[model samples]
Target chain A: MFNLFLKTMYDKRIFIIAWSIGLAFFAYLMLLFFPAFKDSGLDQLLATLPPELKALKGMIGDISALSTPSGYLAGQFFDIRMPMFISVFSVILAVGLSVKDEEEGYIRTLLALPLSRIKLLFGKLIAIVVICVATTIATVSGLYLGALSVNVNLDWTVVSNLSLVMLLLSICMTTLVYCIGLSTGKRGITMGLGILVGAGSFLLTTFAKSVDWLQPYEKVSLFHYFPAVDIVKNGISIWDVVVLVGITILSILLTIILFRRRDVR
Target chain B: MTIQPVLEVDAVTKYYGSFLAIQDIHFMISKGEVVGLVGLNGAGKTTIINLIMGFLRTSAGKIRLFGEPVLPENAHKMHPKVGFATGDMSLFTNLTGRQYFAFLKRAYKLKDDKKLGELCKQFNPDMDKKIKTLSRGNKQKIALISAFMSGPELVILDEPSSGLDPFMQQKFLELINHEGAKGTTIFMSSHYLKEVADVCSRVLFIRDGKLVKDVSRAELESSHGKAVHITTSRAIRPPAQSSLLGHQKTANGYEMSFIFKDSPIKLQQWLCSISYMLDFTIEDHDLESAFSDLYSKDKSEAKNV
Candidate 1:
């Protein structure tokens, strides 16, 4: 099991490095623009904006709060850019863990090894968790360093809480994609469904803020549990953590059962 | 003393969503036996291999390896004692042959690389190059090396020689023979009947998801009988005393051909009775023709039904 885990991680070393640098750089770059927003009368500009632009505010959460560092970071980076980037990255990595191998006929070689299906899947799941945690750390480190360079007095505990929730969100999305990939064993189908779920969750959660009818279904979306702005202001919610963790554990269990029974292509 | 069979598949049947891939298939391979499974395309050859390896579950019945039931949960436990290879199997193309073997070594947890070193020497694949960079035959060599390097007691191969050239195929056959001589139980499926005939002690014939024939190598050779072709000056009725199969006439009824199953002396006596006979030739039947006969017979039988 350890060997399989190490091999899986080694195989994705390049991907890990690229995503870490890319996310960290993006986070740092986004923070560098925070100084400009801090002094600019953006709050007044936002208040005078057309009423129709309220939907954009709904998506970004509390546009008037953009004068503060946490609000600016959440609105510009965490709420949209970071989640979307991490979602895409997680889906790709999750699919490669199983469905891509099955599609390319390499799963047979892996299955022929002296490792049980449960161990094999758990090994891959561990690799995904480690990668997600590493990338989350990189993003937080970038934000921390960027905050220091710009002389912003950011609260470390709030940032850590937000990063933790973000990591959980990434894990939840990745495990869901991994489950779908193992169930279908087709790259295209798995990828299409993964994107649908990720994008749909974001859209549902975003629109639920303003649409009265969608408000009731907001909790159904995985993104609703992320609550980047809320986490930045109020710290992590235990219920949100429990929901994401529950989904991840359920997804892993479902993957193991399906993978053990399905025929290898 | 009683010897246990290395592999036993009892009444195994598999279906893919109401489409029966294989049905009621049963066979056992004892130790030191080199068995060949011969079938045409989509004849459930790979399906059986998958079942035996526990890659696919049996819809009904059971398969046993080394006396324990074969299931996905326990398949890995037996993998250390089994070596498997197939032509269509894809390798991690990103890794060089050396790297791939190193990974396998870690997976299998073998104490040393002595067996792997020997197999590399024998197959002589380009170990330094990436698998994707190698030719089809070279990749096949890597697969073969992977299978045998573990020194498994039971080696299961599916179209194991599909990508090799003639010389390389001969080398593979020699390797199979060498392993068979060393008490390795080998079950291989192939479209190449001559290769099967050369190394296998027993042959299993499958057609349309059914095992049509199972015979020993000597039985297959003798039961195929002699193929005779004759051209005579005058047309004559084939003798009833000679048990001929697939008798056919051509060349304006002057040429006749068929498989003769009777004694050669009896055939000679019958041939001597044909006064107008001009020429005749008799040759031992080959495995290819025998395979054709089995499948053709199945087709005719299906048509009758």
Candidate 2:
């Protein structure tokens, strides 16, 4: 069983390395420009702008805090851009494990071995989760190194905790796509649903901020659970953690059920 | 006392959303038997192989591997004892051929690379080359080497010789014969009748998802009597009332053939009664022509019905 997981990781080593470096570069750039934004008084100018414009730009909360290292990184990078990047990577990796192999005809070879379907499915799922965590670590490491170079004082413990939350959020998104891929075994359906959910949730979460009526429906979106500005300011929420972890577990169970019941071809 | 069959497929039927791919399929393979599943394209040969491998679910009836009902849950138990390869064998494009086999070696948990090395020596595949860069025939060679390297008890191959050159095809046949001699039960499907005729102890002819004929080695080789080509003093046609499978005009006189449901001596004696017959030559019917005749006869009979 571990052999399959190890093979998958090895097969996707290049992808993991590529995505990790790309996200890390993005994180480094976000931290590198922190002082320039604060020193140039753009933070003050942005603070004067209306909330609607900030939300439109995916700032999602107060812009005055853009001068602060944690606020700028979390609000601009983690809250919107980082999560989007990680979620998309996780979904693609997850689908590649579950459905892409089927399309490419590797699943038949795997199934011909003396291993149960549940074991194979679980093995691939575990590999996807490991990849998501590894990418999160990359993002956190880049941010930490970039912050150190800029002489910014950041609470390392808090940064680790935030990274954990990000990892869970990635897990939730990945498993959601995993379930769809396992149930349908069609690359088009899996990719279509993945993009729809990822993009739609971001849109709904942004819209719910100004419109009070959409607030209730925001809970349906995974993005609503991880409010980057709120997380950076007040620390992690027990409810959000529970929701992310719960949804991941639920999605995994649903995936296993569908995979065991559906036909291999 | 009788030994249990290695495989037993009973009245199995399959449907792909109202499209019947196979229906009422039944067969059994005893231990060490070399059986061939013969059919044209779309004849459900692959479907039956998929069903036995537990890739597809049967719509009705039961399949047994070692006398136990074959469900997906229990199918894996037979995997270690069975080796399978299909003509539609696709490989991981990113990995070199060596890496893919190394992965399978781990997946199947073979003791070491002993068998793998031996197979590589036989097939002569460029193990270092990426599969995407290899030709289709080379890919098939890799698949074949993988299937046979493990020395499985039951080897199932679909179109095993497809894309192989004549030399490798002969080598493949020899490999199957060696495996059968070692007491392995082999079930293979192929459209190439001569290939199957060379080694199979029995052949099952499937057409349009039905088992149209079941022929044993004896029946295949000699049941159809010899074809008699006669040369008369003059160009003479066969008597109109003669009983024979088929007759046609040749340059000399006339030639005819029939299934000698009786002895060859009786057939020869009957043919000798032709008054104009001067010289004649008799040859056993070849499987290719025999199968062709069977198919055409079935078509004409269906037309009458």
Report, for every candidate in turn, its global Cα lDDT versus the true structure.
Answer: 0.84, 0.79
Looking at model 2, residue A12 earns an lDDT score of: 91
lDDT top scorer: 1
Expressed as tens digits, the lDDT of each residue in B159-225 for candidate 1 is 9999999888989999999999999999999988888989999999888999888889887666556
Q: What is the DockQ of each candidate?
A: 0.78, 0.58
In the range A143-225, model 1's lDDT, one tens digit per residue, is 87788788888877777878888999999999899888886687888889889888888788778766879989888888888
The TM-score of the first chain in every model comes to 0.94, 0.92
Docking class of 1: medium
lDDT for B275 (candidate 2):
78
List TM-scores for all candidates, in order. Answer: 0.92, 0.89
Could you report the Cα RMSD, in angstroms, for every candidate shown? Answer: 3.3, 4.5
Tens digit of per-residue lDDT, candidate 2, span A123-209 = 888788888888888888789888888888876766776787888888889888887887778888899989888887877776776
